[model samples]
Target: MQLIADSGSTKTDWRLIDSKGKISQVKTVGFNPYHQSSEDITERLQKELLPQITAEIETIHFYGAGCFTDLACQTVKDALKNIFPKSKAEVHNDLLAAARALCGHQPGIACIIGTGANSCLYDGNKIMDNIPPLGYIMGDEGSATWLGKQLLNSYFKRWMPKELRPKFEKRFSPSVGDALENVYRQPQANRYLAQFSRFAFHYLKHPWVAKLVYDGFNAFFDKNIVQYTDYQQQPIHFTGGVAFYYANLLRQVANDRGVRVQNILESPIAGLTLFHQGE
Candidate 1:
């Protein structure tokens, strides 16, 4: 059996595939070397994952957020090796997983818009270039966190419609002060911010909300996608909750920018399964 994982900051999707192509799946809390220690990851694996496996694993392909550096990748690899000592393990950054999953053996541009956002240019087999994501603080233009930031800014400044303010306040029950405290001096601020994107989705019919979504996507195209050579000719693909849920809005933004969207997957686990199975 082989194990494949597609992970982001919010959650992980795990697939167990047997030699005959039979597959089973499970979910666990997300792991990031920058945020969680090796011990923390091992404990979660023991508690949430190990018991679910019914077969001996042969290899483990772990693609995750924050595994961008060798030290970070080694940290996760060591933890996995400690548990499944007999299996060979490979740890890689989530971007490669998105590229493999979205582009496969075809060269194209792959983008991710989940709690955060990122984009890369893939040459059929490997990433040719990448624009720094810079996380939610400095960048992450079209991500849920970005949208949430915009929504909060509008709400706090009372820039949204007067009628919408009461509804927003009632739904979240957070004043501008409370929201500021969470964002400026709180843990998991990105996740906290991303939670509000649901509000944006719910009120998408509102002109203000529509404009916010469009402008955020436009920023992503201008800053990230447009920088690549022949980007307009490449098939643009996406994999993440934000892109999957708001596909129409994303496509609209792409259309306005004179680009085309080829695919949008809610998660990459299925494609990752196929990729690993072929390997």
Candidate 2:
């Protein structure tokens, strides 16, 4: 059997595929070599993942958020070796996973727009170019945190539509003082700020929300997508919660820019499953 894992900051999705193509699944806390130590991953593997599996895994494909560099990938590889010493393990960056899942063997532009945003130019079998998504604080335009940050700003500044302000106030009684403390001093500030963007779905028709999301999409396209000389010709594919949820707006933005929109997946797990099965 082979194990396939797609990990992010929030959680990990594990799939065990047998020779007959039967697949079993499990979940665990996310692992990041950039943030967690080998020991941390080892401990979590022992406590959370070991007991859940019945198949003897022969190969492991791990795609994670922080496995960009050789050292970081080695950190995760070391932990996996410690846990499943006999099982061959491979570590890769999540961007590759997104590309393989979204574009498959076709050359295209693959993007991720969840808590953060990232995009890469996929040349059929590999990433040819990438625009760094320097997290929520620096960049990550068109991401949930990006959208939410603007919503919070407009709400606090009294720029939110007058009709929706009271409803927003009643739905979430946010305080400016608490918001400042959370954003400046708390951990996972990106996640905290991202929560507010969900309100846009409920109020999609509202001019204020529509404009905010439109502008966010435009910013993302302008900064990340258009940087590539051939971007206008390549079909763009997205895999993330924010992109899936705001698919209409995303498509509309693409239409306005004259770019082709191919696929928008809620998460890459399903597509990854298909990819590994084919392999």
Candidate 3:
């Protein structure tokens, strides 16, 4: 049996596969060494994950947000090792997962636009270069968090149309004070902000909303994708909730930029599953 996991800031998708290709899946809260302690991860695994295992696993492949460095990867590896003591475990950054899932032994530019965003140049089997994502605070231009921040800024500044303000207020009912508290004093501020990006999908017909989406994606292309040497030649692939939901807007931006989009997957787990099976 083999275990595979794709984790982001919001959730983790776990898949268990046996030799016959039968599969079982489970979901758990996201874990990142950058945020949670090793003990917290251990407790969550024991409580949320242990009982789901019906067979002995031989190997575990974990690709996750914040597993960007060896130290971060080791933190997760150690936790998984404690839980599945007998299994061989490997940990990798989520960017590699997106690369393998999107490129599949072909060269391409793979991007992730979720709670946060990242992009890398993949050459069949390895990442050749990457522009730093810098998370939601510093960059993450096309991400849900970035879009949400835009929405909040517009709403707070009374920049949105008078008609839309009432609807936005009614849907979220977040007062300026409440919003400040959540962003400044709370944990998972990125996730909190990202929740609002859904509004763009619901109210996409509004010109302001459409423009905001275009601007955000344009910034991503200008800042990250355009930096690559052969960005125009390579196929651009995207994976994550943001990319999947707003694909039409993304494509519009890509067309305006004269770049072609190859694929947009909501999550990389399915492709990762196929990749592991082939191995």
Candidate 4:
């Protein structure tokens, strides 16, 4: 029996593969080692996850956002160990999770463009290259948060088309002060900003909206993809909401850049489960 979990900034998807190979699942709010302590995670696991499992077994594989450094990874590993003392626990960053899920044992470029943005050059078995994903405020250019931030900026500054302003106002009805407070003073500001992307999704074909999406994706490829040595030769794959939901625009940007894109999955959890099952 084994447990597999894939976590991002907003949610964690858990899969328990029993000895008989049957899988049971659960979901909990996401945790970042950068934000939450081991005790906080343990408490949630005890309250939310422990009740869902009946068969306790061998190992645990936890891939999480914000588990970027050795200390971050250890923080999660300790939390997992505390929850299931007898089980062997392994912790890794979310970028590695995307790599393993999207590329498997084949060499390729893997990217995550959901709440956050990150990319890696994977050489079949390991990540050979990675561009550090700075936060959404400055970097993370291709993520949902990036798109939302752009949309908000455009709407607030009246950069969007004249007619669309009313629609935007009607939908969100947010004032400049309100937007500022949400972004500058509120918690989970990333998620708050990312929500505006859904509005963009509804108006995708609008010339202004399309440009916004395309420009962000163009920046993504420039910063994350073009940095790789064999980026042109490597099949680029993505696993995240932004990639999956805006596939047409993302692919268009890739095509314009003369790069090849292979797979785009909404979540890496399913493919990650398959990968771990094979291992």
- TM-score per candidate, in order? 0.96, 0.96, 0.95, 0.96
lDDT of 3 by residue, 1-279 (tens): 999999976689998889899878999988998987777888899889998887988999999988988888898988998899999999999999999998889999999998789999999999999999888889999899999999998899989889889988899987789889999999888889999998988999999888998898999999999999989999999998888988999999999889999989999999889888755
Pairs in steric clash, model 3: none
Residue by residue across 37-80, what tens digits does model 4's lDDT show? 99998998888888888887589999998887999988888888
Model 1 residue 258 distance off true place after TM-score fit, in angstroms? 1.9
Q: Over the stretch 74-165, how does candidate 1's per-residue lDDT look in tens digits?
A: 98998899889999999999999999999888999999998899999999898999999888999999899999898888888879888788
Model 4 scores worst on lDDT over the 10 consecutive residues at 270-279
- Clash counts for all predictions: 0, 0, 0, 0
Q: Per-candidate RMSD vs. true structure?
A: 1.2, 1.2, 1.5, 1.4
lDDT for each residue of candidate 2 in 175-254, tens digit (9 for 90 to 100): 99989999999888998999988888789898778888888889999999999878988989999998998899999999
Q: Which has the better lDDT: candidate 1, or candidate 4? A: 1
* lDDT, candidate 1, at 39: 91
